[model samples]
Target: MIRFIDLGDQILEGQSEFAWWDTISDSFEEFSGNQTWPNWKCFEEDYLLDEVREMIQDMRPLDRYKSLFPRDWSGTFVSAEDRKKRYEKGICDDIIDEDT
Candidate 1:
């Protein structure tokens, strides 16, 4: 199947040796009724925008794609606005998986 994944890599300091996840990170979506580590944030096919998926279909990622990935996180965004507006600041280190 053509997977529509919300690709991401995370770094949890002092967590594990392989904490610095790289390409093909865990999907944001689920499969087989559960989230997979090999892929964490995968976007369900039915939910993905047709145009965005189609555009991706026409091309393949080698290093990185600009349109496909609007932003590549360079540093920690710990500002109050960033925490509030962009990404919510977590209370603990443990990941809290929310069902959307």
Candidate 2:
């Protein structure tokens, strides 16, 4: 099971932001790349949050921080396909009124 402790009061909010690669590197600088940042299905086999925390403490980059979404490889909030569907559905009153 993936355990995500809240990015809580103790984490020092807004200290600074680092790139995605930086976070990954910081979290697993000691380990090989393949071992550090693994695919979701394989992540549980070798993931360690303590190392992640230690890396974040001294790292300086956030260009690639991804949210912990289930299928978010890039960690963006929504997939492109989802965005397109919402757009195609439209958001104006005209669309809603037609159905009503």
Which TM-score value belongs to model 2? 0.23
| Candidate with best lDDT | 1
Q: Per-residue CA lDDT of candidate 1, range 31-91, in tens?
A: 2343322221332332243344555445543223223432443333243333344444565
lDDT of 2 by residue, 1-100 (tens): 1222222122233221111122433442222234233233333322333446446434522212224423424322333444556667884223222332
Q: Where does the lowest 10-residue lDDT sum fall in candidate 2?
A: 1-10
lDDT of 1: 0.33
Deviation in Å, model 2, residue 24 alpha carbon: 12
Which candidate tops TM-score?
2
Error of 1 at 48 (Å): 27
